[model samples]
Target: MLDGTLDGRAWRLNDRYRHHAASEVLRRAVGDPDLGRVALVSSFGAESVVLLHMVSVVAPGLPVLFIDTQMLFAETLDYQRAVTARLGLTDVRVIRAGADRIAARDPDGSLHRVDPDACCDLRKTVPLEQALAGFDAWITGRKRFQGGQRATLDFFEPEPPTRLRVNPLAHWRPQDVQDYMIENNLPRHPLIAKGYPSIGCAPCTSAVAPGEDPRAGRWRGRDKTECGIHFIGGRMSRRKVTA
Candidate 1:
């Protein structure tokens, strides 16, 4: 199904990935004599703070791309600013869907209802692709647990056309991420306690049932859980839709 995996052909990376190895992975990728510019992407979601904090530590000034789909929940937006400020992260850049494009296509921002994929292409994917094009490698916070299509995830992937992808948290368990967040005192998305375990665009996210998978609330009952932004890169890649 997936291609451009590292040494192994399968989706999983070897155990040699090391514990809490994201920092090392980042250092290697960002420091690569071959690769050029490097950047990190964030959604400022439930578990997004962990990676963002880690990025602040590894590369404080690295360009941090935040795609403001303009359809995100209020909680997510607030969390974005809070976390950026709390962590003292610099180089935070926000990407938004072009107003002209939105006015031309949706005109009312309801396009997400009729065609979710294309909505993501315009709101999330296309803009991110444009922003990421300036970099040689990008880092993401994807893990293996967010199942649907991500039962297995890799640490490094090949970005088509050019560039490479780095998954710093591919092996981290959900609890590990939670612990990291708690330990760091990072701001949590306001919607987390509202049962929207996974935050996305306001309209598509909902509350999940007890024992339900973390991502179950997103696009519930529609089989359209992914938002498309993460597909082309990492966290948003398999979980979200994108072309």
Candidate 2:
């Protein structure tokens, strides 16, 4: 449990670390006794290398949670392993949707065609919630420039179930991510050069052209922008809740 209430602690810490750089923000969050335990949630996508590199520098052994929705692109899986090895991340944990759950709800593996929101709930959101149960705080790679609900992204925010979200790169821009990856010699996700600015599951993700939103390819032709992870509050009720 946190020192005080979870929301209370989150508010205070968000204020304290708002002005700090990503490295310092990460260090303080991991070492913060009040938060109990912390973990990093990575999609291992296009801009993920920047934040993962930072975590490797500050706390290599810190738990890194990767949600393998089982519907991800083959290259994403390969890239996950490659990046983990390249960055020397010590505690990379792969969390997945239960086999039984998938068999029951999506035996055909085509649920995303009918209701993408339900697919995300069963494959990503619920599994991640289970993985995060042991952690007091979790970190994400979301940035303000990502647009949509992420336009107001902050360094820290209090999420539901009393957990704090630490967005170390909340203020980082696209150029910042590109420069960090180049300077650090990080391996780029293979699909990036193939026009995929934002990578997600194979079926729901596509390639974007120049001048398109980095996330424009995700859930394309649909009204969905997120896969039910970063959404908070009443937004949860708006989706098909299979959890």
Most TM-score-accurate candidate: 2
Write the residue-wise lDDT of candidate 2 on 1-243 in tens digits: 445776777778887887798889888888987667899999999988888998888999999999999989999999999999988999999999889999999999999999999999889988888888788889999989888788888777877666788888888888888888889999999999999999999999999999998889999999898888888764543232344
C-alpha lDDT score of every prediction, in listed order: 0.75, 0.87
Question: Model 2 compared with the native: what TM-score?
Answer: 0.94
Whole-model lDDT, candidate 1?
0.75
Q: What clash pairs does model 2 have?
A: none
Model 1, C-alpha of 211: deviation from truth (Å): 1.5
Best by lDDT: 2
Q: Note each model's CA RMSD in angstroms.
A: 4.8, 2.7
Candidate 2 segments exceeding 4 Å error: 1-3, 237-243
